[model samples]
Target: MVSLVCTLRSHQDDVNCCAFSGALLATCSADKSICVYSARDFSELPFSPLSGHGYGVHYCCFSACGQYLASCSTDATTVVWSMDTGEIEAVLEHPGRSPVRVCAFSPDSSFLVSGGSDGTIALWDFTSRTLLRTGAVTDTSIVACSFTPCAQLFITGSTYGDLRLWDLNMNHLHAEKNAHDLGVSCCQFAPQIMKGTDGCVQFRLASCGQDSLVKIWIVSLLSAAGIKMQLAHTLTGQSAPILSCAYSADGQMLVSGSVDKTVTVYQANEGVLLYTLNQHDRYVTACAFSPTAPLIATGSMDKTVNIWMLEDGSGAQGKSLPDEAASVLSSGGRKSSGHSRLMVSEWSEEDVLAWLREEGLEAVIDMFKSNNIDGEELLSLTKETLSSELHIESLGLRCKVMKKIEELKMAPVSNGTPDEYLCPITREIMKDPVIAADGYSYEREAIESWINTKSRTSPMTNLPLQTTLLTPNRTLKMAILRWTTCQ
Candidate 1:
């Protein structure tokens, strides 16, 4: 229920901010940089950290699909990164005297929102980083904002106890409310459409303020019509100012970190405390839970990133704790860089054939040679013979067959033997034969048998000899049988 799973110490100064998606966690520091770690192994993943900010980093958050991350700095810039390749997608800068404090991604990942010290909010297109809208605050600086689950609207909170809802499609202010009596430190969009399991389709917003109060609000159509949403509950356990708050994916758990140097996990529907984590020596600045994992990662002013997990979750009960020193992937094996097993199953027959073609004729030759045959000579002979027959342009296939016979006659054989042999007419082996002898100098029977195996059983005339023989006395005779109609 309460344990430090892993600790990352790459940052040199106070690591005051962190963010987690389904599989990754990123932390920001007063060292003016950020480091992202993998949720699977707790080791560093490949990411190019952006560090051109003049001041220290403050906060970071990932998009829904885990493809994009937004990090804000006191240097007045918010940098967007491509999470998959760890490349900077865009750099957002404000024209006024505002230092960017925190940033968040739209649920659909099409836009980004940032809060600045000048009490203004800026919206940037996800791809172009071009400003879409800018809204000025009334009294205090806006510190945080979150988009609804559908990304149609967003809510921004200021230090002067103000919360404003902006309609993204209309590019105008939708609603405003006094969420707290003091500075609102952080705010988040609840995963549910309503606070309770009712038919109401609304969004709940969780905010922590300088009053040490954690408040929840319902942003439904009923509430937008000037009817205030009922405050579901308020958690009052933390003695210091609450700095961060987030809801679990299932909306069953709520986690909050504070200047009180402690982070508390609470039941979402009920305000009862489920667990309390107290590992930080200094104030805990931010905390986040991986949506698909049982992990919880936090950054503290003590200059370290701590990861924890629930006791009953898989890999937390009986599994070994992750060693921070281990590699990101399993060691000493071929890592599959692309397609998985399920991907291969979905490939079509055409895809398989195309893959084979990419292997080329060289692979085919290798396969043929594996059977102890000269595949190169066989292919070359076939090509040349086909070309010659086609060049002659014969109508019947007889000429091509004759050409094949000549090729077989001229082909060099092994053991220095001549290609054409004088076969024995009566036996399977060669021997010395007399002039009138029915025997031959070679195995005519075997050759005739081999040639007959390839015959089509067509009517015979003065057909080409399937085999030929020569006697010991040098008499030569074609093995062809002359079939004639005797009348």
Candidate 2:
């Protein structure tokens, strides 16, 4: 049940890659240009068809914030463009001066790496737009590269049929010599990390190859013997070489394009093929999933990019987060439930608990949890039900709880808390705000998780931390407490 919503026709030559951020979709092609389009309606941006590359553009990717885009080209350089002005931010020449084949940004948008045909990899300090370091892989061309969710190690795939893992200092950690017989075409690490029993860390990565196979592997860190990679699944849906593969934002689904002129979507964990799309007339070169929408984009040698909507059991269209955010923007800062905000009726059980804890209503937390009360349940609560059902004998307590609920209903859904009240590490409002050495405040748990991952860098600056010490931000905490009380 895959249906093509629209076909983009901006590229005059073969489209090499297509990437989507939360709000924008960008496509690179052999036409020596890149086009930017609105993810909402597929309308071209006014500054699109960016033509700065001297040679053909091969790949493009967006930063985590969707504020910038990086594109690699046969011109032996990677160009970073600002999404705000659609202007070039910086041009990084490949170290070996070899034609740059691929590029990837760290999850935190602190670092950018470009892979070159000469097996040279250049890492850039994204904050300063300067080269941090360079390293070489096998003699063969470096074609694919991606960073793990931790942002500590990265995997590179080369035409030599090896996938090598390396740390930030360009130190070789591990290598899989037989990753693909003919050579790896593309590789991507899943966005989400899973914790296993006994404090083990797990990551999943999917790679497509010229051997006409898509392989998924389990990457384990903190293993007794060091890092480990185990083959998890091998999928064979395309008859010809699989060129590109990508995981959906949630990492539940995978999609790949192939020389067979088709795109295959799979249930990643189960290795089950969900759909085989055949809209492209020529070889399918690239494929990507929208991070904020139930949509997939595929590019082909036919010089077109096709957008497909992922429908659920029902045929109703699910709105993209960017579209909702755009609505909020158009309405003059009414704001959308992008991250810092959630509608009263849309809060999860945990969100409700967070609210209760912030409002000093912890005595009723156990009761609310036991009853499985959620956002929807909270809205329907009345003073009568509170006293009779929950057996709240204190009239003042019931009135206070009801007052908080009333404030929730009357206030604009997006008007939850000030952005400063939220931790930079996690978008949610901070319960325990602590000042880090980087001079930024973050939630205790979030910053601790960031440090435990050994990223050991400021999530805000992407620079090395001078100290791991976290000081309590009592003043800010008190201010948040006062604001909540007023609300």
Candidate 3:
């Protein structure tokens, strides 16, 4: 289980991204600033709210040793900050004044790689504060880039939905492919490797895009064809475009954020959804799992950052029992000396219907009713009969059932009227609310439109706007959710 532990409210505008360096949490925003906070208590650091970028900071990352911090911005520059002193050590810029969108530090922390809107990728030796090399991976802007564990190879994802593999020297393209239907927004390598047959190590690459799908690829360092790559699996569940993805330090879990306003955790090897965190009311733009703890940090367009704590023993916790054993439990049957018999024959149709309703299995009940099957029939039906007669394939049905079960298990059941939750402007339950400069809350879209086109003033106060930034009112939102749950 994953539960929201704290919400950080410092960014005046949308929180664009977040990262973790040991016990420190860093977040960047459209306010052209970055803030550092304590991951343990969500307290703002003394030297936080670092402001130097001329434009919105798009991404931020920490070096392997957590000694240095790097942030890329639309100001066409990347700033390297000394974490200890909170001082700028170096500022690297693109030659064409193109907006820098993504950056990564090499595993050894000796070099940094950055990609920008001009389709250029630059490598800089941080120790010397000098650009080592520059090249273009595509004519379109590059949106995502990351170095492999070995630091000899890195991958870049482009706005054109192309994925390219590059050598460390940035002189060779090992392979390239059209990986997604829309812009490839994020990519990361698995933190662990699988040993191949010939003693070579095989790694997995995960990429998400505007296509609302996550694709996994197998990359082998030593193949007969030389650095072979193949599609491993495709995960589909998010309703909107995915913005970011990251693998846990142990590589047993994968976490993804989407514009669908949810963060999903998946079992790395099996590609199964373990949890769906839905506390954010707007697009979840960035997510990162802590390298040393069972914690996750997420930033959203809602203008808030949330830290989630995964329960102990819950990471990548797969099915509890084998397939045969699960079947036996569901049937309420006990194994004899050498045989098994149905033990639930005494359950009546009404009793079974009540149980199903209690368990939120209305869909299954409807299916049974459509087939004119009763409680006794369902209890006695064999697995083969249930599948064949209901025309239900195991894979698809199993996924749906598992997802529903997990959701029900984690969600707090609620029943309440909508009047108290209605937005002041929309007069309906607010899906995403923002606090304007007038000290009043309104739906984000309604307030943005009021400020942009109508007038440069507060709709509620009719006063000239002090600032255009809208801060998220997460406190009220949480209160409304809790009120509904207790009703």
Candidate 4:
């Protein structure tokens, strides 16, 4: 059973949005203020009521690190506020001076996208705090946006009843017009990346609209086959327009808030309604699932935010943490923070930050975040680069940073290697690769870490693994050695 843990009435006006990071929760409202609360006891932080917006705040989102909060307003700007000090870090103006309706940080936190009332979308380089590009759809306000887990693409849903996909370069990859009958109020991609039996990368996206329906779409990306998004299922649990939808950290469950003052939770993949919560006294405007817990926060026009805890044994605790923290978890995690799902050459700026924190090099986290150091940039980091580009004053820290980068480069498939030689868990060329019970070969350290933390299950199939024993993939290792020598 879902139990209400607490109700926050800090906002004198309607609560427009609520977001949670690993340790904190933030809610914004028409009161033109943002409230910060510690997830532990639901107490407002001393520095809360962050008040930089000139007009009613419409939305607020936390960065992946939980260090910063971004909020947009009717005043035509999106402000990034430091959670540590409750101070405004940057004020990004929308391109057309139009009221900004929503803003979202990319999965890696390297980019920020803000959609405005005038149908304009501005993409910003978060590190540099500069506008990279802008796009728009005529006659429609962009109301919702979400980045895919891979960080390579994003989807924006608008009042035109369309969902448009775009790449980092702001190129329109695809568009699904009439995705919703009336208009889309919210859209979010599931955190997990699934691989089908056919080898195509599959991503699930949940979208809700004014039509009182929630949709699950399967987006498939193939190297040569192009991109295809197919409607997988539709949920009609809500009786009125759903305003917000969110996927649980595991991507197994979905929760949405509606105009009918109800929150419906569903089994995402199977499209089964799991629970219907009616604690809100007015139209529910926002909903979010905690990234590190089985808790959910739903906000309503009643000017309150209700926190609900998923009771133990509800299967909510079985899932691993979100993708960013999965590898760093003690069990069912990577061997070290140096390890990640993407190849070292493909790591994003936030990936670098996570590794730094895991490696106890938090001193340089800000330095790396400021420079937007991604996987390729990570591979290229050197003592000289750290000192020169990153301005690290301490020689020891520079040396440590360089050493970690080198370790990252040597950890997995560094670059210029065939994908076949890579471990599915760590995406690194396996030096001591072993075949698991699922007939998949993974690096010894990587697979062991995963098995220790997660249940004895196949990473690819999510099926029960017959055994923990992993046989050495000597032939594949030999092939990798040969390929390395040739390189």
Error of 1 at 16 (Å): 2.7
Residues 1-487 of candidate 3 have per-residue lDDT tens digits of 5656666656655688898988788999876789987766666665677878966798999998888899998767999998887899889986565678899987778888899876889888878978988888655778898888887788889888888888878865565567888679999998666877888778889999999988888888774567877888888858889999998888888889999988888887778877777777789999999898888888997667877777776654332222232222112121221101112233456545544454335667765666766535654455455577765566545444444333322222111234446554443456677888888887788778656743455544334678999999898788776764664
Q: TM per model? A: 0.61, 0.65, 0.65, 0.65
* Residue-level lDDT tens digits of model 4 in 63-113: 889888999987679999998999999999888677688999988999999
The models' CA-based lDDT, in order, is: 0.62, 0.82, 0.73, 0.82
TM-score of 1: 0.61
**Model 1 poorest ten-residue lDDT run:** 478-487
In model 2, pairs of residues that clash are none
lDDT of 1 at 15: 74
lDDT of 2 by residue, 294-397 (tens): 88999998777888777776322222123222121111111112322666677888888877765558888887887778888999999998888877788978
Q: How close is candidate 3 to the true structure, as a TM-score?
A: 0.65
lDDT of 4 at 64: 88
Model 1, CA-based lDDT: 0.62
